[model samples]
Target: MNPLYISQKLFEHYEHIEEVKHYYGLLAIYALLLTAEEKQDPVLLGKCKTVLSRFPDHIQHPRYNFPSYRIGGIPKAYSLMKDYLPEAEEQVRYYAEEMLTASRDRKGIMSYPYAPEKELIWIDVAMAVTPYLLFAGLALGDEKYIDEAAKQTFLMYEEFLDQENGLLHQSKNWAGPGKYSEDHWGRGNGWGYLPLAELVQHLPQHSRHRTKAEKYFKDLSASLLPYQSERGLWRQEIPFEYAYEETSGSGLILYGMGVGMRTGLLDREKYFPAFKKGIEALNQICINADFSTERSCPGCLCPGDGEEKGTVKAYVTLMLPHRDEHHSFAPLMFALVEAYRNGIYDLPRDSH
Candidate 1:
């Protein structure tokens, strides 16, 4: 089936689920709306906003029940909706501003008081939170959020990037010295790519960190492109051989690269091959008729320092495991829309 049909089907199902912060249905909603060929549907957009509005400005940290991870990506979600819903824009913007101020501190390594201490902390806190703050800055046009993202991005690289190899290790102090040491996780790299690529595109050309952001975008793309498996997906662990192809990392990389190509940060000729490979891999998942559209990889606490967990098990145990629950619709929606945007899936002509 075509991606739009898949999205509509998911939306119908989502209508029955209780709206919650972590449901992340908005990610899919935005993808579906953004990719439609026709004029913007006000009603559909309103429905998205209504669901998103249910998310409070901040959630109690799951581990600490404190205010950590407050920089959730609600601002970016609202930013996407605001152009069509100006009346509702204020409310969204208000929430965005509140988050920015609430999380800001001018000292070393600004962060939420509530960064989760879970075993899977790397994925949830590091990867998930980065995009939220980056988008919050872009949507609100605020310096503080942008600065926080930049700082965290740099800090993550500093702390987790292994000197021996260029890839990001999954968490801080993960493996024994030099034994499977500092091996990159596909999703962790994917997590790093999204914000830097998008934030650099959105931030002012002359922002103080513009050069650093550019280097980051270039380095991440270069390091990751070589790892694409012949089957057109990345392995869960970069150095692991013949691992299963994963959708969530593929989608994140696809979206990041497509955005990079769209905004001119990435070279089309150099990168489009990888983009095509990832898109084809993701589309293959759709053709497989798998209901669970996302495959979870190992989750991390600090980069290079924790055990890897899968998607399904994490959700069931409410604790991190090497491999468990599926992230579900995020990778599918993100990849489908990005595939359409990049002309990889031959979306109808009007979609362009």
Candidate 2:
């Protein structure tokens, strides 16, 4: 299917969706902004500017109520729209400072800002915080932000990565100090991997973090290759054979692989078949004619409460897939954008 057509339809659908002030909505907004910039479509870019204008500045934004991490996409969106939005620089700097000063564990890894008392560190934070910081740092000519962006991803990878399998656990401290969630969650790995991919793509060639980031990204990509289902998707619980095929995680993974191929960090010969199959599968199964999405896991963080919390069983059982979840939109858009970049576009049948 034509990636641009599908993306436009999805962007239009997102324009009318309500309650988009949170991370999920922000992610979709960021994806649309990225798409507009990539295609250089003035009309699409104008729509993105309108969408971004709806939010107030970073401090007064409703997303700040939860935690600083959730607002990563906000600054990321602003960074892209800096030319159009006069407040973009201020907003990006504000969030960069928030990330710099945010609470962290003894190891200096960023903790969940919502509950600093708990000192929780999760895979999700990689995606939530890293890219924006990298962008802001690059945009503002602040190396500290860039350092922190690389530092967070490297530290979290060292913490949560399972040496046995190369997959990362979803979170730490949810069960107890030094304890990690049991499952190799699909989306969790995506959260962890995507930032590394971003670093590989954006970090300067001679930057100190460049070599290590590329290695970590390549390592994770290799680890993930073995898990793709025959249908070109990943399961809800990645290593679990019985787990159902999931879209968001699959899309995120594919997006990373696409970046890898484009950047020469990953071997296209080794990865392109999977990437092709994945984008095609996502277009065929997840995105509908009207641009709604399906089979994306809902917002989940260590899933269950009480005894069931942070268990592998809980991850597979409690976090079932659903249709039209907001989380699905950005991931699908990311994969499609990457696919378009790689010259994989095919015209939709109806367009013919």
Candidate 3:
């Protein structure tokens, strides 16, 4: 039941290794964990600030990049600790400018705007920027940031969600209409879930916008439950039972569900079991300690044919998904913290 100890160990081990691209998301996780522990560990906080500061100037120069926007969530960590670390205020500003710019460029009148050809559109881009948007609004005391967040947030729900099934999808391709699978994809659902569960905390409860978002989130959590694998993990493709399960997606689900329960939006009696299953799967993955965690199904914005030569080529060349354990590690640890805090699982006595 010592979540603080477990979280500290998980974070320390990961921070020491510090593999490159994983840093931003993991720092976001650490920010959540530290805030939960109710102690401000400046060392971890400093490490987090260093990672966020380095992003705009990264050799890869993610500032204007689509994938770079994914780091937008990191500012939430800064916003959590900004009063203690005043310097983080500047980093939050820097990230907000870039993310808001991206959202505007991609926004259209009747539909969400697309980012050129290969670039990320609203769904993917919004997932990346949502954390920062919420943070900027609170940190700077700027209603504009919150208003923009609401507008962009609405765009994501408008375009990506499959109205019939009530689950969210990535996007529709430019050249042709896009197809969403019968079941939700784990990561996309994860992306959708977190913003609703966490960011909604900052919005005024009585506002019409928050009420709409809560309804959407409730439906999303309900829709995602049936897709949970018997083993407590979510498959890369929820409807495609044959596809592999991905740990990062599962962890994000746990984060979302746990946040839901914490906020009283999700009915714990109905949804807690699903959340528990998610944690059980995550704990197993951690105990397994596979270096790569579990391989994620390749990232594809569109569901492509496994058949055609061109489709296969596209899946191999463009949609080829790669998996790294770094993403899985931090989220798993964060979920563990949530589980412990919720007292969902009882730790057994030592086997010895």
TM-score of each: 0.72, 0.93, 0.77
Candidate 1 residue lDDT tens string, 93-155: 454455444432233333344532211123223444445556656666767767876776776
Candidates, ranked, TM-score: 2, 3, 1
TM-score for predicted model 3 compared with the true structure: 0.77
Candidate that would win on TM-score: 2
lDDT (C-alpha, whole model) for all candidates: 0.55, 0.82, 0.57
Count: clashes, candidate 2: 0
Find the 10 residues in a row with the least total lDDT in model 2.
Answer: 63-72
Off by over 4 Å in 3: 1-4, 16-18, 22-43, 46-73, 80-82, 103-122, 174-183, 206-208, 286-292, 303-323, 344-352
Residue 217 in model 1: shift from native, Å? 0.8
The whole-model C-alpha lDDT of candidate 2 against the native structure comes to 0.82
Query: How many backbone clashes does every candidate have?
Result: 31, 0, 1
The Cα error of candidate 3 at residue 122, in Å, is 5.3
Ranking by lDDT: 2, 3, 1
Error of 3 at 115 (Å): 4.9
Model 2 over residues 1-352: C-alpha lDDT tens digits? Answer: 5787687777677656755557667777777877887888988878777666655543345535335434445445345435556556766778688778888988998887788888898988888778878888888889998999999999999899999999999899988777788989998999998889889988889899998999999999999999999888999999998998999899899999999999998999999999999988888888877787789999888878777889989988998888788788888888888999998878353311
Off by over 4 Å in 2: 57-86, 347-352
Better of 1 and 3 by lDDT: 3
Kindly list the per-residue Cα lDDT of model 3 for residues 156-224, writing each as its tens digit.
Answer: 766678777676765544324343233356666777776676566667665556877787777888877
Which pairs of residues collide in model 2? none
